[model samples]
Target chain A: MKQQYGIKDIAKMLNISVSTVSRALRDAYDVNPETRKKVLELTEKLNFKPNKNAAALASGSTKNIGVVIPFITNYYFSTVISGIQEEAYKQGYNIILFVTNDDLDREKTLLRNIATTSLDGLLISISSNSDTQDHFEQLMEEGVPMVFFDRVPHHIHVSKIMQSDFDGAFMATSHLIDNGYKKIAHIAGPKELNFTQERMNGYLAALENANLPRNDDYIIFSGFSQANGYTDTVTLLSLPEKPDAIFAVNDRKAVGSIQALKANHVQVGLEFGVIGFTNDPIATVIEPNLTTVEEPAFEIGKQSCSLLIKHIKNKNHEPHDILLPGKLVIRQSVKLSQDS
Target chain B: MKQQYGIKDIAKMLNISVSTVSRALRDAYDVNPETRKKVLELTEKLNFKPNKNAAALASGSTKNIGVVIPFITNYYFSTVISGIQEEAYKQGYNIILFVTNDDLDREKTLLRNIATTSLDGLLISISSNSDTQDHFEQLMEEGVPMVFFDRVPHHIHVSKIMQSDFDGAFMATSHLIDNGYKKIAHIAGPKELNFTQERMNGYLAALENANLPRNDDYIIFSGFSQANGYTDTVTLLSLPEKPDAIFAVNDRKAVGSIQALKANHVQVGLEFGVIGFTNDPIATVIEPNLTTVEEPAFEIGKQSCSLLIKHIKNKNHEPHDILLPGKLVIRQSVKLSQDS
Candidate 1:
């Protein structure tokens, strides 16, 4: 094993005072330029970095941002994290992650136990059924800078970033309508989430614009998973008058819908139609290549991190709401009016 | 916003002294059990938690573990993280995440700049082509406890946890041989990765046992992506004598090989056969479900975290090398001998 070296080692190797090496390492104004260069060269050659916690204690800034999300195994959230990591790397920050697994109790527990002094700020995406904002409000009251993204709280006046869920849902529904599908259905997420309500409203507005009669049986609210989609589609197929098209909240659900339809010998593109949000890689892998509205997941991550850093640097930074648009990716899953 | 509550607030509400409340929070022996019960109840009701940084200053344990990974977008890596998260949560430890994006330079920078004092230990899966371990060696020598997983270093004596790559590869190749495929090709990963070498060896051993000639033209080394699989398959097809079967290193490449075979009008399950490693979710989504080996990714993560925690708790703990076995999942991609 190699011997551990410290600032004292650097000073001894260069035959300089310990204070001079420390000052040079921090690029202090009083240190000579030549000494600073020498210190930097030696540290780099030895692959040595100054202790950040010591510096954090002195400066009262840990340079760590805590990210609270419901899940990380999914494509959308993972992509967003990549964006956040990119921005944090560029700005000299580290992220401490906490996963809630979409459980409100877990979310509450994690927030309650969080070590606020160890983090400069937080980036949170609340649970799907988070009914209370008491824990978050308490943290905010303590002057803990934070920003919310994607699955955010309803009334919190914090900087928030997310995709235009309503608009994307509207575009998806309209695409089906324009292709001559009068009877349409929606496989939605839980009723408590802000995006779920927004998407449902968008779907309703599309039907109203098309002057199509609304049917209560056509909308099914459930969890956000492929299995949920499969079961919901099965329920739709069991209807006396089955819907001709479906708009899913996310791609995994849409893929499930397609599978269910295929199992029942229903031609997906030609006979029935399906469209989804979040252009996950699975969208392309699924047969017929699902058409979807691509959420700006990575951009949301990058911007949220940037905004959180702003809050960290300037505690007085005003909270702002940013909505990114989603683009419609056309593939074989959605049939054209002419083809029909 | 609500008022931020603290230990003083709890004491004031309970009509107790500040030190008494602090002692109760830490479960000090001098504090009365009834007083401790009251403090715990009040803190839970208010969702109040002690400042961990201050506690860590006094106790010298940060209760944070840093996890360094290469990528998070894929299924296997994400699932592995889920396992780690589960264990960390159960142990009451928060995880700090760092992504290297499979770049050796990024890995070096992250390791060199890591805040060792802020973390109790580390769990790492080095980049695919990590050729040097000096940075890791320096940190280890500094008394930083760590455990390696999956893509670990070649010569490091650190505790490591990984799947049985060689055995899985042998099983996959032998499965094809048993199915009456005399000629087989292998689509492998980067030449420098440890698993790649182990898998190649397994494939060679299987071929030798079957009395099959090892054709150097049938083996291709490339990146681990579906595109690489497609291009590699295309190259194999261009050979004077194409192999009757193929064994891919992972599921994504296997999917690509299948797609390429379809594009070339090669009957996948009849005229040829294909097998892959890693039972990613996409295995079922592809037309003829992928039959491959299931790497114990989640188990690896859980065990690695557990081992690291042991190292953190006991500085004199002996290093361990744990190898997990993989299971072969039968599906349509690999045809039966009679069908072939």
Candidate 2:
């Protein structure tokens, strides 16, 4: 590695005191504009980087944010990241990503080893099975500003931003009922996930209001994978009393259920109805299209980051929860009846 | 904000010298087991984290790797990241991501601002239109360890890992010919990318081997998006002499072309054939189940990271060129004449 130039070296090169060079770089009013311009130009030309340790020690700020998420390979999460990136870029902050792969052990290890000294704040979406909030509470106690989004903890008194999962689910389930589908099945994500429970509650409420009999067998807890969707749908189809409609927790599962139905040579649009959450791009590509509730993933990201930065700047800021509403997008997947 | 604990606090708490505490944490042989155990217990209890900057200053290693990519929302890139994350986790390293959005200017700025002091090595996939590589050359000259994957620069003599684009393209073209497709069209990505040129070359070589006349007009240099594929396919269809087969650069574009064909009421499998690269999950959801070349994205990521780490450890190691072969996945998008 090349020898890194330090502030002392730059001071000697420019024939200035170390204190003066530092003040100039920090844009202190005590330094003349001409001197500040020269110092910046020289640093830019030499690609000189200030030692982050010394800077952090003096300023007590790292200008770095940590973002912990379960995964990043999906459209919803990726789009949310884009939104976060936009806000962070505007505020001149850098984001460091940590993925837990939805494993509680990994999440614990990550939190335990996180270098809070180097992070100004944190934005997280807890893993599916993250039942304990001790680690998060500990971080908050340490005055590390934190904000949660999407799949967040239920009882944490931190700033959180998420879509209206319950309302979205109710709309999806109600859509099925309005379309004249009496027997509807719901394919859900892991029961441990907070959003899954919220969505399930909405499904139940919609069924209750419609005065339709709720069958416990119609609600299945599966993974978020397409294969999970297929297997769950197959299991539902094999039941003694099969439902005429299916409500998937997310678009991937919905696509999988559709594929399973098509493979079994069962007419989808006419004989069966399906709806999904998260209006992923695949929803449009699937045959007969998919009717889905569009979650405001990007907005959640932008708002969460913006809120976290506020907490970082002012530690005493009050925590708030922001819930964006979801919209129902109708397509060919569900058949409309005269009752509508 | 809560005051962060330092080694001085730990030393005061244990009634020991700060140097002894640091040494014990570093697992130096000079420290006794009892002292080491005491230091570990206190550090763990207090959740004390050694300042990464100070540790890096002493050891000349940061345990951080930088990953520069053009995009992350696509299936191939996301899966590759999963592989990289798996290996990185095992090796006790953290990855810092830098996205350029396929803009050459953004790539230049990001590389220019990269802090070599904060990173042990870099893994990069250059933007499509990165015509100048001076920034990369400067980093190499400064002895920064770096490995390029996928969209690598041709002028750089560094280690590179990528799929066997040439061979994969040849197989795709040959498959079309074997299925009785005499006239074939190629919808390619940006001409500036190395992989695009390699794939195009493979297509040309296959046509030459079969003694078929190669029409320059049949090959179009578009983009790597679905909209590009749709528009390009529409243009091809409008031509007086349209090709019977199309080979898209990726799955998204292939789906777009299929949508275009279906909109025009063309018979997909019999009257026309479509094939795509990168066997994304969407391939199955689309009508007729797209036939594609499955790129080993995860393997590429793992191998690239492993190789980069090796080079970081030993600067004198010879550069390696790794080419992983892709598999031909047969599906309904392309039908053999014999089967018909």
Candidate 3:
């Protein structure tokens, strides 16, 4: 029969503790460099291949964080994942990715079927449905630390990191108004999303402060897609009272709006103004370049993962909500008003 | 141990083999609907978890496939992931993602640290470095069901899925030549990449077929990035004899080339011509809409994942190589020659 060896065996051989060997194995920053070097040399000499799962089971420290997202095909989500990956790599941790495809049923089954025993913690941006909140709550009850980013549940008392959606919307609307555009409309995301409602409130607040009449017909709720933005803009254009400017929930929708305007032979920057949130790369590619407020997608991802790791390390850590601000990026989309 | 109830108990209740019960639990397609329903009902009643690692150890099936990619922030890679995710979902498999950030050292460490015991198979797009092929060959020798995709390793007899790079490049270069651009320079990806060399060959072949002088100075090899395209274009434009057209390796680079041309007051699609491979969405957004050869990114992803799953199911399965064709998508970047 063959005998098995592990970090503990190496620790005993080196007159060290198992925790020291584990930290050295994970390449943790706190470990002394000389001790780490010694551990590595010994492990290499012994040809030790650590069984990640076995080590995780024994110590309840997996050095892995599970990230559950809705979609990765989009610019924002993928960029966010890049940020998360960067931070995870720097911290000597690995992330496992799960996609829900934005279906609540799949979201539910995925959560329910998750091997929580294997995961040290979780980071999730859910399907954005209130009904699925219970599944998240169940995960929390299991003592698995978690942090929600971007699309988060409203009433959960957990760590969360998000971009400043309302402030960015306010900035976009004010920029359009400042550019001498009066008849303004907004293309919003699905109404149920927390950010959607917050952004809508900011837009409305900006309009009310400027004493502009609010027309119910000016607000359109649709999916966060370019096609939705295009269709919504078309609907707005066909109205008897055409808007002079449009504030979009996202850049993709804004791109769609610009395309619809171009297809109709409408001069975009010279006449109709468009301001979008989330300065996607396509913002620069579109003609008359899109004016946008850049969402802190990467920062949000980094902060969320960083926060989740803190919670995992200390169970009693207090939950906090983080709202990173967004900044307006000036471009060619909005017309230059002659007067300030 | 309380006579530990598990999948075996469920199998006994349904008068089925344990493998059938496991298949039903995994939501495999061939399982009977009635049998699956019964199995689900019994499992639900028992509150069974079937601890993933334990079940995998018992049956030698983890039902998880690991995917190792370089970057997901780009359009092609993200779209490929979408295809992989769709196919994985349909086939009742979960994908574990690992990104190497295009670093050879990181790639080596990641591949070495992979928990092979917990994974059913592997899907990899190598970092396009010859040095890392040894790590892959070691995995293959260990009998790990694996498939290489897109950025494949050379000198390895393994199942692989990639777009027809040489054919696509030929189409791109020939289209430029046919449009009356005699001095066409190509800004290509890193020299070590398989696709980069293949694309370069196609460009050389097109020039040879047209009886145009092939200048060694016409080819510039650099990183796969927009910045690379911009800098390379700047160098070409500054040359004593500037090329009349530019064919870039990818759409982002094509967009960069167009931007550089337009910045220098060189009218694109009129005075100068540009063409690209990989008709990314940015192709439409870029001014003068890039003419390109669209790679079958999504198809390659789906085929690779599907092939890996077949290998996982049967270790002795024959390995195959697939090369899906790319099609030319004409928009406005290429100039219309008057004589032709």
Candidate 4:
């Protein structure tokens, strides 16, 4: 490897003092314009990048924000990351990405070893299996400025940004009931996730308001995958009395439900209705384009990052929560009757 | 904000030298057992962290890798990142993410400001419109090891990892030909991307092998999006000599093509066939179940990151290219004919 040139070497080469070189590099007024220009030219020519560690140590700012996400393979998470990246870029901050793969153990290890010294702040979405909040509490105790987004812990007293999951679920379920589907089933995500619980409650509330029986057997707890949704739908279809309509936690699961229905020779949009949350791009591709709740994933990311920067700059700032509402997008998936 | 504690403060608390404190934190044998235990206890209690900048200055290793990508709001890229994250975590390295959004200016600016001082290595995928190699040359000259993956620049002298795009395209085209499709149109990505050219070459080769004419008008250049695919397919259908089959660059575009066919009241699987590259999860959601080529995206990410780390460790190591083969996944999108 070639020898790296530091500011000291540049000072020596220019026959200038070390402090003068540092000041000139920092654009301090103590250095002459000619000397500053010489240092800049030489550094640019040599591609001499000052060690970020040393600069961060001296300035007490690393210009790096850590983003910890549960998963990245889904559309919502990926779009959120894009939004975060845009905000971070405009603010001259780089993002350090850490994915827990929705594993509790990995999340614990990741948070434990996170180099807080090299980060200005942290943006996190808790894992589904993170039943205990010890890891987050520890980081908070250490005074690491962090903002949670999307799948956040309910008990955490930090700034949080998320879509109105409850409202979205209510709207989806109500839309089905209004379309003359009294028997509705819900394919939900892991029960441990807070959003899943909220969505379930919303489903129950909608059924209650419609004067329909709340059948526990109509709900299925599974993973956030198409396979899970397909299996759950198959199980529901096997029941003595099956649901007239199905509401999925996400679009992927809804797609799987539709596939399951088609495989069983059931007519979608006519006989068995289906609705999905998170209006992913796949919604349009599916036959009888799925009706869904449009989640503001990108906006959540942009707002979370923007808020985190504010917290990073002002330590005394009070933490708050921001909940963006989801919009109902009616498509061909659910059929509407002439009567209310 | 509370006063951030460092190794110096921990050493003072434990009544030890800064070097001994650092060595103890690093689990070095030179430190006494009792003193090391005391240092660890104090540091843990105070949440004191070693200055990454200072440590990098003393030892050239930062234990950080930079990942430069074109886009993230897609299944392929996001899944690739998941693979990269898995490997990076196992290797005990942190990943810094930079997104170019497939824009040439963003790519250039990102490369220009990339701080080599804080990163041990870099893993990159060049943007489609990136025509300049000067920024990459600058990084290479600075002795910062980097490895390119997927959409890489042709002129760079670095370890590059990518899937066998040509073979995938050839197989897709050949499958269409075998299914009695004489006139096939291709929806290609941007013309500047090397992968696009390679895919086009494969498409042309498959036609020549089948003794079919390669129509220049059959190929359309556009961005990698479902909307682009839809518009391109519409344009192709408007021609006097319409194609019997359409091979899209990706599954998103393939879905778009299918939608266009459906809108035009054309029988997709029976009359007009559609095959796609990158067997994205959406393939199953689309009606007729898209037949496509599955690229080894995860393997590409893992191999690219591993190679980058090796280069970072051994500066004199020769750069090599890795091209993993893709497989054809048969589904219901194309019609099957019994020949044997």
Candidate 5:
């Protein structure tokens, strides 16, 4: 094992005082430029990097942003984290991560136990069913700046960033209708989520615009998973008057819908068109590549971080809602044209 | 916004002294059980949680672990992180994530800039081509407990937990040979990675045991991406005598190989065979399915974090290598019998 070197070693090697080396390492303005350069060169040569905690203890800012999320195994959350990481790296900040596993109790306990003083700010995507606002409001009053993204809570005056869930859902349903599918169904997420209601509204609006009567049994609100999609699609197929198209909440669910349809001997693209949101990488992996509305996950992550940093630097900065638009990626999963 | 509640407020509400409340919160032996119960009850009622920074600063234990990884955008890495997160949560520890984006310079910078004092331990999965040992050695010498997971460096005395890459490779190659494939080729990852060499050796060992002459041209060292797999398979097809089967390092490349084979009008499961490592979710999505070795990615992650915590709690603990075995998942990509 190699011996650990200390700050004094750099000072002694450079024939300078320990205070000068410390100040130079901290990039304090009082240190002379020549002295700082010499100390820095020696430190670099010796392969001794400074301890950040010590500096943070001296100065209140820890240069860390805590990110709270429900899950990371999925494509959307993971991609958003990549964007957040990229932005944090560029800004010389680190991120502390907390995963609530989409449990309300876990989320509440985690937020309550968060070490506010250790983090400069927080970026969070709340659980699907979280309804308590006391913990969040308490942290805000303590002057901890935060930004919420994707699964953001409603009516929280904090800066929030998310995809255009309603618009994307509208475009997807419209695409299905334009191709001549009058009977359409939506596989939606939990009924409590903001995006769930937003997407459902969009789907309903599109059907109304097309002068098609809405069927209450056609829309199914459930979990956002492939198995859920499969079961929902199966139920839809067994209906007296089956829907001819499906607009899923996410790609995984869409993949499930396609698989269910295929299993039932229904031609997906030609006979029963299907479309989804969030063009996850799996869109291509599925047979007859899925057409999807691609969520701007990375941009949402980057922009949220940028906005959080702004709030951290200026606590009085007003919170704003930023919604990024999603693009439709046409593939074979959806019918290009319908012929009866 | 709500008013900030502190220990003093809890003490006042309970008609107790601030020191007694602090002592009770820390579970000090001198505090009476009833007093402690009262203090905790009041704190819970007032929604007052201990500030982590103050506790950490006073006791010099942050109750946090730093996890430095290459990327979180893929299946293996993200699943591994989920395992780690589960363990960390159970242990009442928070994790700070640092992504190097698989760049050597960025990895070095992240390591150098890590705040050792802010974390009780570290769990790392190094970049593919990280050769220099100085940075890792320096951190070890500083008495920081660390555990390396998959993609660990050689010659590091630190605790390491990874899947049995050599054995997995042996199983994959031998399965192909047993399936009546006399000629086989391999698509490998970067030459510098330790696992790459181990896997290559396993493939060679299997070939040698069968008394089959090894063809130097059969082993192609490239990247781990699907594109690389496609190009490598294309190159193999153009050979004067193409191998009857292909074994890839990971599932992504296996998917690419299957796609390429199909594009060239080669029957994968019957006339030709394909096997891969890491039973990624995409393995099932690929046509004809992929029969491959399933890496214990989540187990590796969980064990690494557990081992690191042990080291953190006991500085004098001895470090040893732990390897988890992988299983062969049977799918249709490889021929089931040699009836032909």
Candidate 6:
């Protein structure tokens, strides 16, 4: 009636696919820069602004971001959420939470029923048990902007941010080796997680650098918990050639290892050395303060949220892979010198 | 159009107020039972159903609940959230989270800008610094259902749930006295919080029952943190007459007190004794393992969520006050006996 035009009309005039015009309108990175420039120029000349699309893109319109995580009752995750919340609050956005309790089925179900209309974007940390990318792929196809942090799927081509697990593990293993521990054991997380695999590879690389033999029995892959660490340590202790030191996937597991070693009347700092990833508060509380790699959890959360907002605003934003480094925190858990 | 009778018509026919008819339709607890029955019978006979109103009352119409909390980084709050998430998930409700970081201004702003249209109800634990109930009252006036948990306002007539702080504190102090610790000191939370007052009262009641002196010098009120506990303990130690035992409001403070006492070369389990509330995991990790009263954090969260759902479904549901009991958990922090 009033010479109103749609993206379809723009596509016809430019001799391009409707999707290409739509992507161009949203300033998607995949769209050719020259083509996007032309599309914007033509739209500005024709005053081709769709009311509903304009309103949807307005600042703070549905100013909410959904965060899907595995658990909230742990130090690492809760601290990460704090960082995300701080960033989101500063940017005038609200966070809606969905917890999967590390169960894949619940993660799938939660993702399936997420109300995309109410959320501007999503920040997800895939569950440890998640083995498929189909659920996330479907959401992306429906035009829901998302970024994954920490535990993430392997194949999805989206923004992902996490701590440098491989580098941290290498540092942890090298620290143990430097402390004069002859044979070292590793308590790892679930075998399926790529981070765990990366950590294992780091541990392997460190052992190879030091010209140590690879003992499959010394590496135990299990769940991420103190109990897992305790059981894994007990299994190591029962071996014919017990390891003199242990490197845990996290501080909780390291604490468990300490408890198990202490229970067996072994001197934690003297007879055996222990190193952990994630310098959790429990590291200080444990009898012998734990030596660990401090993950850049807060930075990961902030950057992931910021990257997600970019995607939400510009639909064609290029995917990014960010890996923040971790520092080794020296403490009493590992022996300081061979003489001591 | 067929003569569709609204709630106003039903109220006129029954010679009752429109508000009364509306409350009766929703099975409100405050209305007279006989009046509600009469209104229901009349509505049934006349087939009086308002489409929009009925649709608003339908199950799962807005299957989202907002959870406003002070902090998610602590063990107590995180455990409570786990319970809330479990209950809400079971009821097919998604949770939207708001963290105030225990700041009153942030809490007020969060409450003021909360989009009621997106949430069916709210589950809140006000910040430690919040000194007013006006924001909550305004939300109630808008007919939004809500339930307060843990840290709640004093006068609001809303469904509130918390632990039996007084009883737990009394038990902790009494345990100290029974073990022959004289000159017991209490390190507490913010004086403005009712729970902290209740805990202080419990400590006083125990001292009175034991014929011990009521010394204001022995009580210190401060923030709830390990740092607070450490500073308070340092202050206590500097007094001309030092305490023989310390009863902390929470385990974090207790751990700090232990650290301070240990630093001062005081034997925690021998020359001095320490007891704490909220048997946090840190309680076990602290040297000489802390003795404490375990708060029913999970139960409080589950019950608060369940109660909020009741308020959401039935607008007339009565406000409730629930206090779950805590029990004494004995460990090595306190001396076992006077002879020892």
Highest lDDT, which number? 1
TM-score of chain A of 5: 0.89
Each prediction's DockQ against the real complex: 0.50, 0.43, 0.48, 0.53, 0.50, 0.20
iRMSD, model 4, in Å? 3.1
Task: Give the worst 10-residue stretch by lDDT in candidate 3 chain A.
Answer: A1-10
Q: On a 0 to 100 scale, what is the lDDT of residue A337 in model 2?
A: 87
| TM per prediction | 0.91, 0.90, 0.94, 0.89, 0.91, 0.83
lDDT by residue (B1-340, candidate 3, tens digit) is 1115677888888889998987777677899999988887887667565666555555667667888999998989988888887788778777878899888877877776676766789999878564558878877876889998889887899999999899999999999899889999999998989889989998999999999999877899998777788889998999999999999999999999999998999999988999999999889888899999999988888888899989988888999989999999999999877764
Q: Which is the better candidate, 5 or 6, if ranked by TM-score? A: 5
What's the CA RMSD for each of the models? 4.4, 4.5, 2.6, 5.2, 4.3, 12.4
- Where's the lowest-lDDT run of ten residues in candidate 2 chain A? A49-58
In candidate 2, what are the lDDT values of residues A1-340, reduced to their tens digit? 5547888888998999988887676555678889887887887787786665556656778667888989988988888877887687566566777889989888987886677776789999999999899989988877889999999998988898989999999999999999999999999999988999999999999999999989999999989988999999999999999999999999999999999999898888789999999999999999889999999988888899999999999989999988899999999899888768
Point out the higher-scoring one by TM-score: 3 or 5: 3
- Chain A fold similarity by TM-score, each prediction: 0.89, 0.88, 0.95, 0.88, 0.89, 0.82
Clashes of 3: 0
TM-score of chain B of each: 0.89, 0.89, 0.94, 0.88, 0.90, 0.82
Query: Order of all candidates by DockQ, from best down to worst?
Result: 4, 1, 5, 3, 2, 6
In model 3, where do residues sit more than 4 Å from their true spots?
Answer: A1-4, A12-15, A41-46, A128-132, A338-340, B1-5, B13-16, B128-132, B336-340
Please give, as one word, the docking class of candidate 3: acceptable
| Runs in model 1 lying further than 4 Å from the true structure | A1-39, A44-48, B1-39, B44-48, B338-340
Evaluated with TM-score, which candidate comes out highest?
A: 3
Residues B1-340, candidate 2: write the lDDT tens digits.
Answer: 3447888999998999998997776555689899988998888787787776666667788777888888877888877877787777766677777778889977876776566777899999999999999989988988899999999999889999999999999989888988999999999999989999999998999999899899988999988988998999999999999999999988999999999999999888889999999999889888888999999999999999999999989999899999999999999999877853
Superposition error at B124 for model 5 (Å): 1.0
Query: Candidate 1 at residue B110, lDDT?
Result: 85
Give lDDT tens digits, candidate 4, residues A1-340: 3538887899899999988877665555667999988987887777676666777888888889999998999999999999999999877789999999899988876786677878999999999988999889988987889999989997989999999989999999999999999999999999999999989988989999999999888999999898998999999999999999999999989999999999999899899899999999889888889999999999999999999999999998899898999999999899978885
**Taking the tens digit of each residue's C-alpha lDDT, what string does model 1 give over B1-340?**
2336877889999999998997676545688999988898889777677766656665678889999999988888888888899888877788889999999988987886686877889999999979989989988988999999989898988899999999999999999999999989999999999989999999999999999999999999999999999999999999999899999999999999999999999988788999999998889888788999999888888999999999999999999999999999999998887753
lDDT of 2: 0.87
Over 4 Å off, model 6: A1-61, A338-340, B1-61, B338-340
